[model samples]
Target: MLKKLCLALALLVMPLPFVATAHAQGQSLNDILEPVRKEVGLPALAAAVIKDGRIIASGAVGTRVLGRDIPVTIDDRFHIGSDTKAMTATLAGMLVDEGKLRWDSTIGEVLGADLPGIDPTFAKITLEQLLSHTSGIPTDTKAIYEQYVDGKAYEETLSQSRLRMLRAFGKNPLKVDPNPTFHYANLGYVAAGAMIEKVAGETWEELIRRRLFDPLELKTAGLGPQATRGKFDAPVGHDVDDKGKITPRPWGPGADVPAGLGPAGVAHMSILDFARWAGWNAGEGKRGPALVKPETLKRIHRQHVTMTLENPPPGTPKSGGYGLGWGIAASPWSDNRPVLGHNGSNTMNLATIMVDPQRDIGIVVTTNFPGPKADEALQSLVRTLYQRFAK
Candidate 1:
């Protein structure tokens, strides 16, 4: 396994923008990406670069499955995994702008009634704390398995199940000081999603679809596995075994993380649409359906906590400042201007987004296969993109 690196780019320069070489201008995105995909042994790879809120270049290459001839098109959707966190955080910002929520909104203020016996300390965790992963909720553990993973809670609504999680986990003493300690916890985002659900009276999925996706015109955006049921209409995720065998997990409940954790991550879309989202962020509400104030959007992009992990799990940040849903860091290649980014994976696929607001440029990369090779592939592709486009 590759040593865990700072951010996606950190693994490759510590880790985006434009000016293609004379020859690069003649090259299609497929021309740029195919060899890297082959070198990395990925089933498929896709990428897009955006400038001033539009995709300037994008492409998808390789097959939908490893041992198949079916090819993937630029329109094929890929699972974004934890990159969904930034979307969830942005959705929260929308609510905050509407006065339905606040950055400082506390758990007790939102869900204390629902969770009557909640620990006072846990209840004090705020919306900002939750989204920033500073809420001190323990990371996945045995208790999480017993209360959530094992039960699956198929009978309960997504919101209902999240509430169940809040009730069960809220009673425990927090794992760290809720203020400064940074522990990346998906459960915190789930709790924040539940809080949004409580105030909005809609499931997180429904609210995001209407409030965020519809307004942004992200038509291909959806929850769960990116591929349609029983059809490889999109790139299917691949699981790599220790022996290096790749198995296609095209579609199913088992293909993704729990539905209750959708708030934490689990969004997918076409590479172009993904670029649209990143470009919107890079524009900082400069153009919009005006989802949130530019200032509010800035708040979401601004780092809230310092990440000190020497070795983070694959596809997450190793070192950087984490904002509500974004990772803020200066790459070795970026000349010290902090860039906003995040990588997502479900152990079957990996997706990455990097935005350079100062340059009004954003880069996104995705692969149907997940692992060190995929990370390295993205790192190389992103570096190539920056070298070609950011001039």
Candidate 2:
């Protein structure tokens, strides 16, 4: 009887064919992300991949605070920077859907007496042109930041002052004819946000919360650090100085939030919350409650204008194209896979969010540090993740 029991135990201990199968199927998402993790010096990263309106995989790596060793969770929030533009564009599309505005309506028609020194030519600029950044208006955020926003409250006086500056300089002809060619300008989105306020009769933040965030149940997503303060964990922002040491910057609210520039940059969110946003875009207006109609999202994703490498504009790589508020890049891992997404950078942080709509796959990465090579590292990590999942 003992010999017979021993023989049965040996048989049970022997590996079954399904063991290898299960091992292969259960390979961790971290397996693919680890390489990029080491290369990028990302102290913390939270990411999720969606497929068919479901979160197939989600995880976090490294630390939320560098020296604290507080591990990052999927809900850790980060400054998404220009990805805010996508949210702003969605809001604009919703306004269009609600009949509050038209794509062809001129900026002057909406802004009316608020903007001074009105150029008649610019008065004819359409909402579509502003959304696509063909309004011929230069991005004045840098100058505005240096001159007015450093430590002061952005009041109506400063807003009017900037408008005067824009009117004075906006007389130059457009770099490319509107609607058929792309030229990214942050001022265009700033103008779009202003239009939202003017037409909706509410502050931009209140309108966004009522029309966009509340409807989608994105309780934690907002235009500035104060919105999420004490409600979620946030990462510190950093930049490498000339001496190559990582220096920390004061983490505070972004001035662009209240200045009607929410459409260009200045959004705050967590990876999990942003994943829900990606799911909505990837699913084509099917995920969560519908903020904008399917037709509106389709218009947002359509390649309304072509971007050329020879004359790449601000806030974009020479190799990428602009579509509405998002960036379009050719996917390296698939045959003719055109990925739609955006990359964002501020003084102390860098971020990228990409989605392959056909495959229903998306990646969201945020880092606290900024350097010359950070964007390149982000692009490379995106490529690596695509290769891993594509196979």
Candidate 3:
């Protein structure tokens, strides 16, 4: 709600009749996105507007990499960093639907036999807390890097590495005493992913592809780096230097946030496919391939914890309710009704999605860039689309 007024400002500047005419005539989303992309100096930007379970408007604009002539298309894949958490959570929900797990399923109950040395406190942590970021797991960048990059975690299998991470971090004392305090941590998702994969007898990567991607028909979706190693087949994520220069990271281990963290983030797909996922979530089980029961899906969207940010960091909500992989907040554009939203970034690329189940509307925006400018550009575009579409 902090920047809700920006949408109001956008309303004042962008005339209603013009937007109505453009929508009626099936105007290219490029017309609306190009100016914003230029204004923000993003390498590339893609977005789609989903209304009533259909992509009513969609577009991709700008170059594949900044300072290059190679252009991007609507089909180009873009990395959606932590937004992958929702998919992982959804996978857990699927397991729950199949009677493989439960929301109250504890780490000890699921993994204690495997990890005999797990901390007693950590052993009691529930799947719900892990998904909601209320499991007392603090953000530990050092632990992640030590395990994934600097250490030998990458050499082992993904599931093995995650187990190692759980063993290592579980020994530490809880970050918060009460157990339900909100402390966003990628590690929590990693642990949750481990539990899901263990119960399902597959890796998180395979589970996501089979359980979520294939079922949702998100053909463009994939794990790890979006672009191919040698070819610019997709829009590569760009890194902004201290001098404001942008560099595209297309290949190598550095392209993604470590394969082991797949359960937490490191997913990429075309904007339309991403919009399809958003649209399905917006449908709130009304329309679906029935990935999970409608009540179960609704439970995932329900707020589990309240996140109160005193001085919100870049790309974070000022204050909102966080559900399983979703930021449940009131969208001013939607008359302040609670909407499911989330922003994902790995400091190179950014992706944001907002789903209004009540309205059956979803807006997804992604760019081959990150930081304040990209965030503002996407937010503005979302507001613009909400103004034109959400009828």
Whole-model lDDT per candidate:
0.80, 0.61, 0.80
Q: What are the runs in model 3 whose C-alpha is more than 4 Å off? A: 1-27
Which pairs clash in the backbone of model 3? none
Clashes of each: 9, 0, 0
lDDT of 2 by residue, 1-391 (tens): 0000000000001111111112211223454444556677766655555556666555557665556666765556776777877787888888899899998987789876776656677777788888876676654545533432433344454345345444544554445453455555666776777777678877667777788777766667866542233432566566555687865443444312333345567676776677677777887777658778888887887766656655432334566556677777664454556678787656566677777777777766666655545555555555555555534
lDDT of 3 at 121: 83
User: What are the models' TM-scores?
Assistant: 0.92, 0.80, 0.92
Model 1 residue pairs with clashes = 9-15, 10-14, 17-389, 17-390, 18-389, 18-390, 18-391, 19-388, 19-389
Query: What are the per-residue Cα lDDT tens digits for candidate 1 across 253-330?
Result: 667777788898888999888888988888887888898888898899888899878667654556779898888877
Error of 2 at 84 (Å): 1.1
| TM-score-best of 1 and 2 | 1
